[model samples]
Target: MDSPSTPRWRKSSHSNGDGGSCVEVDDANPGHVRDSKDPNGPSLAFAPSAWNAFVSAVRDGEFSGI
Candidate 1:
C-alpha cells in the first residue's frame, strides 16, 4: 500500500468523461473515496467489509431510486 496521503486514485468506470459529476477511489486503500471535482476536499473511508457491501448494493440496484 502507498502512503494514505498520496494514494493512487481511479475514477469509477461509470463516470461521465466530460468533467461531469464523479468520484475517485484510491487503489492503494480500497475504501478511501473523494470527489473528483474536489480533490483537496475531505474524503470518506470505510471498513473493507462495509465498502464491499456498498459495492454489492450498487450492483444489485439497491440505490436506484434513492
Candidate 2:
C-alpha cells in the first residue's frame, strides 16, 4: 500500500473553473484517482491496462457529455 504521503496529487487539466466537477490524479501511480474535493477520502485505483483503456476511451469521445 502506498503511504498517504506517497502520491502527489494533481488536479485534472480538464477540471472546470466553477469547481462543479473535479478529478485529481497521481501521475506517479498511473492508476490512482481521488476527488480533488476530498483529498483524504477513499480513492479508486485501476490496473495499468484498464487505466490506459479508460483514458483512450475518454480521448476518443466515448464518454462525451458526461
Candidate 3:
C-alpha cells in the first residue's frame, strides 16, 4: 500500500496518444487528482461520491451537450 504522500498514480487510458492530454489519478487517495504534466503543481480534491458521480457522468455521456 502506498503512503498518503506518495499515493500510486496511474495515467488515464482515455488520454490522447500523442501525449497532448495527460491526466493521472491516485487510487490510494480516492478523489485526489492532479495533472501529469505538473506533478509538483496544485491538486484537486473531491469527495469520493462526487468523484464517482463525475466519472459516471462522463462515461454515460451526460455532458454531451454539443
lDDT of each: 0.88, 0.87, 0.83
Deviation in angstroms for 13 in model 3?
Answer: 1.2
List clashing residue pairs in candidate 1. none
Candidate numbers sorted by lDDT from highest down:
1, 2, 3
Deviation (Å) of 46 in candidate 2: 0.5
Off by over 4 Å in 1: 1-6
C-alpha lDDT (0 to 100) for residue 39 of candidate 2: 89
lDDT of 2: 0.87
Model 1 TM-score, 2 decimals: 0.77
lDDT of 1 by residue, 4-24 (tens): 665889998867889886989
Worst 10 residues of 2 by lDDT: 1-10
Superposed Cα RMSD, model 1: 2.8
What are the TM-scores, per candidate, against the unseen true structure? 0.77, 0.84, 0.78
| Candidate 2 per-residue lDDT over residues 1-66, each given as its tens digit | 654457878998878989867999998788899989998899998988999999999899998886
lDDT of 3 by residue, 1-66 (tens): 444666788888767778777888888887888889998898888887999999999899998783
Model 1 scores a C-alpha lDDT of: 0.88
